[model samples]
Target chain A: MVRYLSAALLVASLFWLAGCGSSGVSFNGKDITGLMPDLEFSLKGEGGETVTQARYQGEAVVLFFGYTHCPDFCPTTLTALAQALNKLSDQEREQIRVLFVSVDPERDTPELLAKYTAYFSPRVDGLTGDQETLRELTKRYRTTYSYGEPNESGAYLVNHGLAMYGFDRHGKVRLFMRNDQPVDQIAEDLRALVSIQ
Target chain B: MLHTLYGALTPYIFSPITVLLFLLAVTAYLVGWRRLAARGRPPSAWRSLSFFLGVLLCYLVMHTQFDYYSRYMFFVHRGQHLVLHHLGAFLIALANPLPVLAACAGDRHFPRLAAVLRPVRRVLFDPVVATVLFVGLIFFWLSPSIHFDAMLSLRLYELMNWSMLVDGVIFWLVILDPRDPDRAHTSRFGVRFLMLVAALFPQILLGAYITFADAGLYDVYAICGRAFAIDAATDQVLGGLLTWIPPAMMTIVGALVVLRLYLRYDSEKGG
Candidate 1:
């Protein structure tokens, strides 16, 4: 009777003691690992060159959907991405490419988009397409965007999704990193995604 | 120049009410100690030290960079929570300042004060009451609406922090009284140990929910923009982890201490 009670108590204590220590690799972002559908589409990169998911084979690709004129979200996210990428070694940095897809294709011409993205980091490539093509591409990812009516200056803002998606070397969507994550954490998640075979 | 001044002074900005309240507590403790010495019943060195450390930590958590950063970072906020509740409360309970205060009030006897405080103390220190208030306050503040709203209003934020500190002191005092003269009403060490252990389950459950959550629970942090540029989701995860881990370790240590004390008492009694 005494032995049984002691054993039972010990087991119960263990249950209460359980937690805190993670049993697996803890992710800083939502682990949509292997959950997202294949990212397949061809978009026009700078200089009107066609860019496809296949082009980034054997390297981790990061995609952000926003316009260059976004005063806060786009510039902040791109700056953070630049800092996060800077934390890595030259070799590790080479294995990653950041693509900024401008939702406001009307104003974000190929040249303007290229120059804007290049200002943040050399590894960042600006991707854009015409209205229908951009709409279809965004639709594939279940992303949303809406253009406000032009103001007194005949300029309008495009509101769009603020999430960044990470694809592993095999082109599988692994990270759904949010815009607010700190640079170090994003860097850590990027490192993990890049390490994935 | 104004921006630079504001930036430099932001971290040291302490609320007038908080400063006043803590200063009053220090005055009471000091006056109480002096009275105790005059009566030839000076407090133990350890208890005095423990109480002072607790008060110091309270000031540090509230007035320092910790509080300033907690306004921005989830993990730092969680750290502030831990200090206010577990460590500060534990050390203050070890000090057990009530008797000292009573002594200071009227040279070891404050009949009028006792009349008012006695019943209040009885209800406040009841084991079940303490546990419920402590645990309920934690969950109440952590609730998405309250947590989110608290960030928007300075008064609500102060209320949340103060309540946590008060309830923590109340809860820990019940478990760590050291001399429970009313044996029947007070919780025994074994029972207190069990209660602490039980508290860990819900705490860990909450932490896991936050850590593994698919979406951000506190939208204010995201809306305000993370000052550190920490992704909101990542900040939430790290905060959840901090909430889950340190409290469990503290509780485990507390339980072990209780168990050891229980064993020592039993052996001394030859039971």
Candidate 2:
């Protein structure tokens, strides 16, 4: 029993050394596995239906972490997502859905967020909720954020990792796209990911 | 100054070296666009290199202006600033193109950077940020007291290099960032048109200053300066060209890039 406990302690120390324990993401969350932590979410999209892990299953989804109030990065990224979609052939474009989840739920109401997403692309959907639900999803995606930095204003910024998750038609996470990975590369990667199944 | 400008204007400046370097750049660009160039615009490296060289050429022009001004005529100095900041800066920026580093790095490094920038790239790449910075820098530099200070102090010479070389590169990056929504959100017609106009202002101001100044701006280029066979009047015209011609070429080329982008899409209205 003592030997087994020592082995466990050694593994735990390794994880702690790597800093994954301090991360808000599930310590068990797999970075390369095509599986997001099966969290339930309600996206204000497509007739305002409640979206969950099952709904995204068997569909290709491109997900982003952002807020409506973001002047530079958030809105621009959403637009690029839209443009990349638009660049695809009709068949390819039809098979994909872009999700914009607001990290700031305090101000980004569903209706306001919906309006912002609609301006860029109709196929784009916005998601937001109370802190509890937001925290749950952010954990599953391994996204990190903080409030009120470099100033005392109510304004806050998210310093989350900027990778796009590509879930195949199986709803399994298949690939990750780094920020500004070029329109063509993302498009080709998506095509390959979708064609896999 | 007139003699120097004359020497620069002669054929050697536009020699086979320009063409050879441009062609070498073309080859590099071809390699750069391994995927897209075949199908779409063959993203031209020649154009970008030309822009880089144009900025360097303007740096040389500033050298001449410095030589002209040490003797105390202020108008030529002012004209030089106008040239370097707006005209020279924009043309250089437009010509050099943007994210050349991204293009050169290829598929692997790009994704990592993209991931890093995903949440934050837009802010750094925003056209408005560059526009505001450039406009603000010019606004600050244009203040009369500042102008007087730049003329009197040796540091303004260095500062001019910063505004023209550094700030110039950044502002042009935005104006030319085709993928940047903050920039493209303007819609091509208005954005490109505005870019040209904003680019043209400094050049126009410089010519007006030189032509209208009551006394010569630089002591070095005073009436008593060495009389060249070409004469000072002709040299001033060369200054105007140095300020205006390269920018005009850049703008026309920029318009072409924008128009080509628009036309490519317009023709693809199969959707």
Candidate 3:
């Protein structure tokens, strides 16, 4: 009986240990290392050319999903991201890229996206895709987006994810930053993520 | 139009294990029902209907596009668990499927399989173990940190759902066993009643805690975005109500069933 009890205790402790597994680097954001798939998507880039995850190879990528017309979350989060990037050293900033993928392909053309993303930072790229591609990408990441009914003025709301996913240099998913995280903490986490290699 | 309907009906995440288990169960039940009918000992239609409805409800929640909403919305996830862990499992146990399943097995094939499963069943069906698992799983998965991880990881998410489902079936089966404890050595009806009541309070406490909390207990839905635009607090409250009310009602319903069983057994002995 004692032997069986010890075995059960050992097994329970092993599960507890497994549940607490981490990547050894702390961040203000939720550590999601190995919990999600590597970054991958094919979308229309701001240059009117097809772009894929391959273009961002060898750089840390932050991916956020929203509509260009998102009145609050999009602009606020982008601004916060810009501020976070400003806190990083130029050398650290050089290694980071932020991809803002608009889910409203009908309204957000490449030119509009380019202008919108450029307002934030040169390192930020705007991309949008057809509904099918967007659905696939969002589903892969276990997030989703949906458009609301258009009102009298032809404006509609597009609900999208507020958290940003951070991928390491090798494109392995590593962190998830919530919209409420502070700019300084975001920058600190980015700095730690940058030094992972 | 048909294409859109088909897309909605198709599974959000297909699992062969789930499909196979469901198919095998349906086939076995049908075969056994036919055999029993031939023997003039068929179960009541209501019981069979309960079994099929229970199985189908579980399948629909886990396999259909409903799963997508459950993943992205807190309230829907709670509803899915309500069906899986309470209503669906309750109906299935109420159907008393063991006799039908045993008839299908017929003591001919898979003796070794039965031998292997016997010890496993013994451990799982222990009254204490069953009660702990039934309540503990709800608490375990709803822990904010664990809930966040389960929502993110596909494998963990699947495990979480399947565990709740399997544990629910085991727990309800223990409580709703049709055999008389004096004759069949099953759990005493009083013990089953205690298990139901024991499992009830923790759930009520947790649900009340979630409902009345000032802030969102689960951030995964916000992080992943919702199926539509709804306030986080509203969503949490709805999820909390789902967690609180229906399950407590199910516990009462289960207690009533045990009481009826006890009364029936007492009369049988007296008469």
Candidate 4:
């Protein structure tokens, strides 16, 4: 009985290992279909109005987490995203929404977030929430954020995720865009995402 | 102060299953220990302390705010596994709580359940199977793609942790069975030594690979964000070292314990 059981376990593990090989439509960005939960959040929008993911039910949503005080990666990533959006056709652009969720809610008020996002693109909408709500949203995506120690001037930095999550029109998670991904490739992936039924 | 303490003690992601299983185990052990003491066969105080301490360490790492850092930081994740799969599990198995646990099982209740589980336990405890599982799990989870997915999915993440703890306990139990092989028909000491040595080298190699790699191998930590502002390379190297050195030392300690057991049994038979 022991020998048979061990053999069965061996075979089962082999099958599991074999199943790890992924195959599908290849994109420059990592394909995350079914790997993450669907897009969902109830955050405070630019005007202090409550915004839920349900508001963007019929459009593709690209979600990013950062702070207005982020001096480097946040602006660079947002600019790259803006450039990517510029490459898309007018109608294609209309089908996508870029959400810049601020993780440093203490320093990034809704008005500041709105202004910061406006400098990037019209497709971008700024969002922030209370720390608890932001924590829940980040945890749902398997991401996290932390604040660094304040400097003598009371300035501090908030570290956050450097990837963008793409959700389809029907709110299924589809793509994982790394911060290092090229703008044209991001655009191409977004175009493909837009065409997905 | 009390409120802050409570916040730190609370689980970052509460798992009812973990809490329930831990409660059941502690309750059974306590009940069985008292029963044995009444019968004049109580385990030593040192053994009891080891058992409780082991369980407590595992619980603190798994159920407290420490779990949050493990999720977001590479080095903390390695430290968590080190406790689960090496230190904590090692202490629990070294305590040899089997007899006490069996006392709880007794002759009256769960006979059918014990009978059903006997074959499964036999298979898991087989020296070859135990060694393979002990080493294979490390490699399987550390594989970059699998690591990425496991860290992302809550169910898979929980499964990964629980499997490491379960497999670690089983492997150590096989090595640290207090019974003499000749009389108790337990696994041979030589075979147990072989299992320890076999499990050691692959871990060393994997650790070295991660530590020496120029580029960051685990992008998941970066993508998900880290717990602090430490460099990614520094975190990876620290995690690699944690994976490399302490576990190898534990294996050596385990072998020495096995050698002592062998000598004790030998002298008992010869004298």
Candidate 5:
């Protein structure tokens, strides 16, 4: 597991890691052995470009999986995550990143994901792609998601578990914050994990 | 702030010494929530709240100091009284059965306290007991002789304050018994309104009493006015109105709101 994560980190740093954004570390684009598996996947962006795992390597990341049409859990989790981030002092908090991954890739073009994630937190980075890529990423991340047929409004929803992964600066999952936990605790946990020198 | 109230160490059932104690009492239910979520654990919220409240009471009694409010406007000081003792403490009791005495019956005090607190609980939990205590509390302070006596002794004043706070809480706890299955609904809005009503109902009557009462009451307060130094009668009425209005509106209307919410929740659940 450890090597797998390290490999992902190394490979991801190749194309991205530009302006690691005050997180005080940058991926060498060299995969570290015995860590996270390398996950090179194609994704859509609002302005029509490819987003890959490499884009987020070496940054402390908060990753959540859901679609744009979620009713309760998605919004609640996002709101809670934003609140947790808000609890910290600006400097300590700014050294973090949030990524939204769309499980319902069939309809969740990168554009939809980007717009949806933006509603909750400006720091959020949304990534979506073709069906195969989304499926592979979701499976690797252990994200639980299921799709429902489109309803009358031509929009269907996906029910997904609201779990967030907290990654270290090295792009390694360090802590798991459940959606239902209090925001203060979540923020504290995130800051503590990131502050670990 | 904790330093201002001496004998704050001696919690006295209502006025706890430290904010830390208050936090503990407030967070007790979180333990129960976890238990329910995991092992189907027996509820420890009641015990936790009781212990926390006891800690506060002990802190208050040991270090009771009134310097902070004593320095401020008298009304604000009294407002503090109506909040911590009367409202805040009661809300804690209703939300969690800080059945402090009921739970940790000290081995030594077991027979004695039960003998004492049992009747007290029976009467307190009863509506008639509540009404009488509530009425008696109103009149006791209103009477000049008793009022003067209360002012003369800090202990007396503190005792009355504590009693009123506890009695006030006990009164509503019985009225809006959260433990009662029929009254308790598993709805967030219902619970919130339940809290609002429990707080508001008493205020309505008290507000009415002060708004139109003919005679001046409470010589201790009338003679010794606090902030903005109004006349004794005016202060007394104003105090009554202040006490009555917000809490009453919160309690009754809040309850109805809760009932509406409860119905909605039931409809949603199709139960």
Candidate 6:
């Protein structure tokens, strides 16, 4: 009975230690830490400056692929992320960067992208590139995109991946946030990511 | 956040057929209970309670957030399947409402009601047929293409749910019938034990395949997208694990019960 009690105490202490362990990042999104390969990208930012994974070193980065014309998912996701970022303290918010990569280069120019992202939050940067560059980046990320057939008015829809990835301070893809996650949960995840360093 | 989650998870539409079926179950139970009491042979409280609980579960699955959120999350969808196929079916079978129902219908002349259902039962309630359907429909509905198609169409989704419920009830009703004279004459326990064993492997294989797959199987979740974000791959894996573990345990429990019954019968005969 003493031996059993010792074993139980040992187990309980181990659990307690685990509960108090490093960087208590309870991600609301799927934890893809070390499961996914390092995400690499180079695109033109809203200000026409070159943007790469290295640019946001030492900060938690959020990357999304969407088009400006997307009727629902794109705006909703951006707004939710904005709300989440707003929930953070200014210092914590400074540790996070959000990149909205436009899948529709034909319409979402650098200026347009800048305007669109600015409407959400100043911290959110809009990124766009030529079709070939965008394709290459999306392929590396395992994201899908395609242009729908043009209508009579010559307007077409671009359907792209509705997911976003979160990278920790070390620049490794650590979380895959679904399109349906609530705003506050996203804020919690962002807070955890901010403390990663 | 929790309120928003709950709101997103609540059922948006009522399924007319499911509601109709639930009403029928309640009416049948009430009529059976009353008739049995009038005859001074009231159905056992346990049986009545089990049947009522089964009907309630059936209603809950059809009309609650369980049904609503199934459209988004793979794990929730698997959960819906488990509730319909296992727990609800088991309780309904244990209730064994057929005799009571017949008593209600035929004014205590259950044989007359049984005679009316005889031909239909002989064809549809064959143990072998039930076993095949019980196992086959699980694979059929869960196959990626079919599941994806069902998600896209409300009609197909309803059909899938109804068929699973019906097949589950039929399979359990046949296997768990304590007083099926035909089952007694035949070595039914041995057959049931074999059926239970046979049902385990295909499910395990399917579950493992889904669990370990590199990519998500269903495209509907990918295309339509969820309201809150969960990684499709991770959700698929969790859903697959859900399918794998619980059903296997249930089958094992069922097999153990069959074995115990077989042993008891053998020991009694030896004595």
Best by DockQ: 4
Candidate 5 segments whose C-alpha is farther than 4 A from its true place: A1-197, B1-74, B84-86, B98-119, B180-216, B221-237, B253-270
Which of 1 and 3 is ahead in lDDT?
Answer: 3
For model 2 chain A, give the 10-residue run with minimal summed lDDT.
A20-29
In candidate 1, what fraction of native interface contacts survive?
A: 0.00
RMSD in Å for model 3 = 2.4
Question: Lowest-scoring 10 consecutive residues by lDDT in candidate 3 chain B?
Answer: B105-114
lDDT for each residue of candidate 6 in B53-86, tens digit (9 for 90 to 100)? 9878877777775675676567888888887887
Please compute DockQ, using alpha carbons, for every candidate against the native two-chain complex.
0.02, 0.01, 0.53, 0.60, 0.00, 0.03
lDDT of 6 by residue, A76-160 (tens): 9999999999999999999999989998988998999988999999889999998889866765554547677889998887767
In the range B128-169, model 1's lDDT, one tens digit per residue, is: 566766776778788885675465445567777887888888
Q: What does candidate 6 score on TM?
A: 0.57
Docking class of 1: incorrect
lDDT of 3: 0.88
Superposition-based RMSD of candidate 4 using all C-alpha atoms, in angstroms? 2.4
Better of 1 and 4 by TM-score: 4
Reference-based TM-score of each model: 0.57, 0.36, 0.94, 0.94, 0.37, 0.57
Reported per model, the fraction of native interface contacts reproduced equals: 0.00, 0.00, 0.63, 0.73, 0.00, 0.03
TM-score for the B chain of model 1: 0.90
Interface RMS for model 5: 34.0
lDDT of 2 by residue, A10-60 (tens): 335533322211111221112333223333465444345566656666667
Choose 2 or 5, whichever is better by lDDT.
2
lDDT of 5 by residue, A1-197 (tens): 44344434533452132211222333211112112233345677655688766776656777777777778777888888889888888886777888777777767676777788888887787777777776556545433345566778888766554557667766654554556678877777777656745
Q: i-RMS, every candidate?
A: 13.8, 30.7, 3.2, 2.6, 34.0, 16.2
| Model 2 chain B lDDT-worst window of ten | B219-228
